[model samples]
Target chain A: MTNIKKLISKPLFLPIFCMILVMAVNIIFDAINGNFALNFFTISVRNGILYGRLIDVLNRGSEIAILAIGMTLVVSCSAGTDISVGSVMSLAASFCCMLLAGFGVSSTSSYNVPLFVGVIAGILLAGVCGAFNGALVAFLNVQPMVATLILFSAARAIGLLLCNNLIVYVRVDSFGVFGGHLGILPTPIIIAAVCILVATVLLKKTALGLYVQSVGINRKASRIAGVRSERIIFICYIICGLCAGIAGIIASSRITSADSNNIGLNFELDAILAVALGGNSLGGGKFRLAGSIIGAYTIQAITTTLYALGVSTEQAPVYKAIIVIIIVAIQAPPVKAFFARRQAKKAALKGGVA
Target chain B: MKSLKKINGNTLLLLITIALFVVMYIAGCVVYSTKGFTHLQTFLNILINNAGLLCVTCGMTCVMLTGGIDISVGSLIAMDCMFIAVGIEKWNMNPILLMVLVLVIGAVFGMVQGFCVGYLKIQPFIVTMAGMFFGRGMTAVICTEQVSVSSSELFVKIAQTKIELPFGAYTNNKGVLQVPYVRIPVVIALVVLIIVFLMLKYTKFGRSLYAVGGSEQSAVMMGLDVAKTKLKAYVLSSVLCSIGGICFCLNTMSGSVQQATGLEMDAISSAVIGGTLLTGGVGNVIGSFFGVLINGTISTLVKTNGKLLSSWSNIAVAALLCFFIILQSVFAKIKEKSK
Candidate 1:
């Protein structure tokens, strides 16, 4: 019982539980439809690729998952959400496609340059944008949201200009490999995994995680303790930009085009939501990277569940809002305190009776 | 020079914004003289086109003064427009009643968000973001198609009612006298602007907002109710936003799910560019009004150019936003140094 209680008290437990609860909805849904209750868990291989609703969730969730990795670090270090990730993603994709398709050539069947050159250039550009935001926030003392808001509005417009106000398409088969399947697994899933693994290793294997957390908790104190708080924050923003770049590349590759208007639209909000849902405080402090990864997948699961239940695309957001409210309300400080008080009262009463 | 040194950070910021607007307007006049940008009518047309934005910006200034933000305004405006359109064209309900209903909905929406943010201590961004999602979803639920107020005579009359200016009449290329006129929405927006300005300047509630935003801990020590102040600020913002939605409806005379998609960003940017600090405690409706004009002028300038892509306006606004932010920071540093 003590071990169980300890497990329940773990910080990651809540996010994991929330994810399971979201998936459990599928069980009831399947039962009601007279199918096997475990139908959602069933995964079958189709022509050397994974096929299932869960697989769909994983496949579709890659961009957000990768974004959440960077978002987790930024939130932990700076205590501010980067609202420009979506636009930066769109911008990166546009730049990559523009480079690959050779400027104003809207559509092309071959690479204008080597594929890796365009990809690296796209990610580097996003990093540069992130550096600008980091400079504003860390050095100039601008609020993160305010600093990022500049890119939030300007990035897409800049992307449109880069693409000559057209959707640039690279039709090469090699171009789709990033978004396509790799050895019976979707390439996006692998990319997201690689990003998460690299981020995890970087944080855990070095003192970077401790530095980020200490800075987040108290910047002045950390500065006094010999931590370059500003540099850490700047590095986190660069990482976030790189992550958004990768996600942007995958997104454009999936569609085989750089759609300036639609690529990664509203994704910044989703990435933020993923971080929030992962049981991390937006105020910045200690963070659980695992919780954030789970949270990202859970969001995709919710969308998938809504679709499988036959909810229309237009109506999905309403249900999503309701679900988000319930989850956040459960995690709210007042509600937790209330529950703790009630539990303490009951325990005291039971002791007195005994 | 001594008096200038004594002018304070807030006023200095506002003066910078005013100067920037004047300079930009003058530059526009010089560059686009052939396009009649010098006409007084051109200026009034900016007001006419951005009346909804002006109202929304005023509301944004209120919430921003309290160090809170309400990004749900755009989605709420879209929902309001859809509601108004459906009420008049489909349900045949009286337009006035529908307008009242939208205000009530706005109040309720704001209250819920405020309760969550103030009482429950949820982050304001999260609560408002959820509100944004809910508003947009409700809009789609209400109607998936474009619904216009074409058949409703009362609505059309209200939308088309022109308040012609006694002056600013110009002789056109056709050799006829042309009078510049604004629709009813512009008058409503100006009234709202003045009312908000007065309320922010004179009312106890307004003073409390500044106190809370300036420092929550200090406000608590001062025996002010921070939560209630935040709640009221949000409620006022939403109520005013709904009014802006009505003006928006009057301007468009149509409702679609995608209506006013990014208006919240526009309002926030305007408030910021107008020298309203995002961290709160310093802003006014007049500054915000000029911010709207500056944005409107940029779009107009781009349009007059005709060769430039429409996206250039967004880039210009962003550059201006960055400039103001950096300027505000520099002023902050100077104030700190002097202290």
Candidate 2:
């Protein structure tokens, strides 16, 4: 009983409970409203909702989930948050598109070289951008936000300039096939799964993950203990960049074109929101990859649900803002502590009365 | 020598800005004289048109000096434009009343953000970012669409009236190079700059802002009301942003959500280029004014050249931002080494 109580008392346990409760409430509300129908027999089918929409959500969520994993690491370092992840993603895509175009791979081409080269170039360029961010924050000791903001503006401009402010559509069969689903599973899902497995192994089964947590918990103490804090921070940024690059490739492929202006716009905010919603501290320390992935799904689900309910596009930002507020408020330390203390007080009062 | 060193960081940035201006001016003169472009007038117009950005940047510097940031300023500007458009075009209200209303709204928005950040202990970035979303969202809800002041007599007067100097030539082809009436908004902006500069340099609140930003823990131990100071700084920033927005509307005679889409970045870049440390506590309102001018001139140069894409303006601004940040980082290192 004590062990169960302790488990229930864990910080993340409450949020997970809240998430489940919310999902359940939403499901019940939808059912009562007659928007959903479930059959308990051998085969179940939905009449109103489309399977394509679900696939779309999964494809979109997968890329963001992959990037969020890397963002979690970067945020776990004492270094500041990167708002330039979207810009980095765009830069990667633009570079990839440019490289493909330069290689005489027309939009009508059936060649696979463009697809292979684009992915590699995109990831490499993203790594370089990440390395630049790391150098500014770690070596130069610049604030993370400032260092990243500079690149945020510069990198996006560079991307747009390279692409000449136009959408670049690559017509490679392999590229389209790469984004295609294997039976019922999407390519992005496969990529996300591989990323998550690798990330989990690195963070949970290695000393590097422990060092990252230690550095986040106490930079001075970690440094004193002979941890290469700067190097770790650099690596985290590189990972973030690489993840963003991969996400960009997937996103661009899904659209079948690289949009210089709108590609990966405000993705960093989504990634940060996902990480924060997962109950991770912005001040650094503990990280939960599973929680982060759930948070991404939760956000995507909320948007999808809202859209399905016929919410106007113009009002979407307001709803998104409200949801973000609720999520942050729930995660706020004082709010959480207040609830915990109130529960404790209630128990104590009952005991006293008894 | 000590004082010089102390101000050397600011001085170096100022010198670089002046050099850039000189280079741009020389380039502009050479290009215009050679091309004899009719669009040279448009270049001047662009510079005059962007004076609102200068005002916003000036306010941004003040808030940033207090170790706080206000992304909501962009939204505040949007709100200001909406209110001004409604006041003049819909309600047939006085321009002064519109200005006052915009300023009040800005103050309230800033206060709310400040309350969350200062009193509630929410992170400044998160609070301001939320405020940004809230402000912009509310503006869209209220306006529902773009609002234009094309029919407003006062707005037209403010926009069209321009003062001409004796030193410049007048031509009918350009509708007179000089006018008797200077832009009232520009004059207001100038007055605001002077007042803010005085307050920052000579007031107790200003000193406290610097002290708090220098080190919050130390300021608290010193018995300064750090929260109040920070709150006031944000309020001041919002008010300035509103006024800047009004100025922007007066210049363009229109209000739209897209009007100041990327103005926040411009303001931030200007503040940084003007030698305001991103880490906070050190900045000058005057420097930010020059930073805006530099930005305005870059776009002007591009427009006057006619051969270059306007997108190059963003590239130039980004380059300038990087240069200033790198210089500041180096200066900070030097200061640290000296210490």
Candidate 3:
């Protein structure tokens, strides 16, 4: 009983609860609306893969979910947020499009560019941009948000400059693999799973996670303990960049075009919110990858639910914000303290009765 | 040597910012001279055009001085503008009362965020980001379409009332003579900057802001009201943001949900470029004032160049921001080395 209670008390429990709560609400809403033709709760097999909103939540949530994984590390290490991930995604998107289309935005000419070239260049260019951010944050000691702000405004310009501000359509049929299926599931779902798997292995199977958490908790103390704090921070940013690069590829591929101005817009905020929802402290320290991954899907599910409920696109954000604020407030330290005190009082009363 | 120690590191950064502005302005002038942009009015126009930004930057500087940030200020500007527009257009409300109402709303918005940040110990970024979403979402909820204040006599008068200098007029290529004057909004922005400067330099609250930013625990040890100081800083930021919204509305004579998209970035970049350290404890409003001017100069230069991509301004501003951040980093390094 104590073990079960302790497990429920973990930070991961809240996000899991939220995920279930949203899913349950969607199910109830669907049942009431008599939308039996399209099942909202159960995943259906479509061809050789899965279909329905359950799969849609994970599939659509993949991009920001990948971003949340990278963000989890950066946030845990530096106790700060990166507002440039969206721009970096755009940068990567533009580069990938440019590589494939040979700087020609219109697909009037066949893209002779190889698929591998676009993917590698997209990932690398974003990594380099991330390096610039990391250099400022890790080496120069600038605040993460301020350092990232440099890229946030300019990354679009750089993206536009690369593609000459033209919207590029991906003409190659082969490029569809990124957005299409791979065996029994959507490719993005597989990519996101691989990303989580790799991150889990890297953090759990090695000492990197410990070092990062220590650095995040207290840099001076970590430094005294012989942790290479700067390198961990720099690598985390690079990882974030790589995640964005992958997200950019998926985003562009999903649309079959690259619009630097609009691609991955506002994704950084979503990722930050996801990490927060996962019960990870923005002040940095320990984290739960599984919880954050669930948080990402929960956010996506909320957006889906709002759209399904007939909320206009503009009005949807308001509902999402309201829900997010409530969740965040509940997670706030003061609220947590209140609950803890209340529980202790109940325990004392029970002890007196006994 | 003793006097040099008194000048502080931020002063060095301020000097560099001033020097960069001078160089950029001279370069702009050289380009302007050839492009028929040499009028004295062009110089004043920069100040006038960026009146809203100037006010926003002043508030941002104060907030940064307290080692906190308010990303929602941009959304607050949008909300304030929308509220005023709705009041003027739909309700037949008094414009003065509308202004007061928006300011109060802005203050309450800041107070809520401050309460979360300062007392509840929530992260400022998260709270403000939530606030940003709420403000922007609320703007759309009130009215998704643009609300034009151009029809309002007061709005038009405020927007169009320009304080003409005693300077001469310039004849355009069409041979039409044009008399140039700074708008009333510009005058208000400059006045606000001066007032903010005085408030920061002379007031007890101002000193308390610096003390708290310098070291929150130490400030508490010194018997300072740390939470209240942080809270007031946010309130001040929000109030100034409302004032900025008024200036912005005066410039546009309209309001839309997207009126000030990413304006928060502009304000923060301005504060940073102006020599205000993000870490807080050391900065001046005068520097933030100049940073606004620099942004205007870049935009004007882009406009005058005619063929340059609009993205160039963002690129240039980002580059300058990068350079200034490097300078700040070097200053930090020097400070650490000396210690």
Q: Best candidate per lDDT, number?
A: 1
TM-score versus the correct structure, for each prediction:
0.97, 0.89, 0.95
Off by over 4 Å in 2: A1-8, A14-18, A37-56, A103-113, A329-354, B1-7, B35-47, B86-98, B143-145, B170-182
Candidate 1 per-residue lDDT over residues B1-339, each given as its tens digit: 999778788888788788888999999999999999998888988998899999889989988888888888999999999999998989999999999999999999899988888777777777787888889989989998999998788889999998888987989888999899888999999999999889989999978888888888999999998888888888988999999999999999999999997788789889988889888888888889889988999999999999999899889999998998898888888878988
lDDT of each: 0.89, 0.75, 0.86
Give DockQ for candidates 1 onward, in order: 0.69, 0.44, 0.63
lDDT of 1 at A307: 87
TM-score of chain B of 2: 0.89
Compared with the true structure, what per-residue lDDT tens digits does model 1 show for residues A207-294?
9999999999999999999999999999989989989999999999999999999888878877887887888878798988988999
What lDDT does candidate 1 reach at residue B113? 86
Write the candidate numbers in order of decreasing TM-score: 1, 3, 2
**Candidate order by decreasing DockQ:** 1, 3, 2
In candidate 2, the residue pairs with backbone N, CA or C atoms under 3 Å apart (3 or more residues apart, or in different chains) clash, namely B164-B178, B164-B179
Task: Please estimate how well model 2 matches the true structure, expressed as its whole-model Cα lDDT.
Answer: 0.75
lDDT of 2 by residue, A1-354 (tens): 789989876756644764565456556766777765331111322353224544556666887788888888888885367778888888888778777765333353443345677789888999998898888887777777777877777777788777766677777656654456655567888888898999999988888889888888888898999999889888888988899888878777776667767777767767877787777777688777787887776666566666666765444556666656666666566677888899899999999999
Q: Which candidate is the best by TM-score?
A: 1
Chain A agreement with the truth for model 1, given as TM-score: 0.94
For DockQ, candidate 1 versus 2, the one ahead is 1
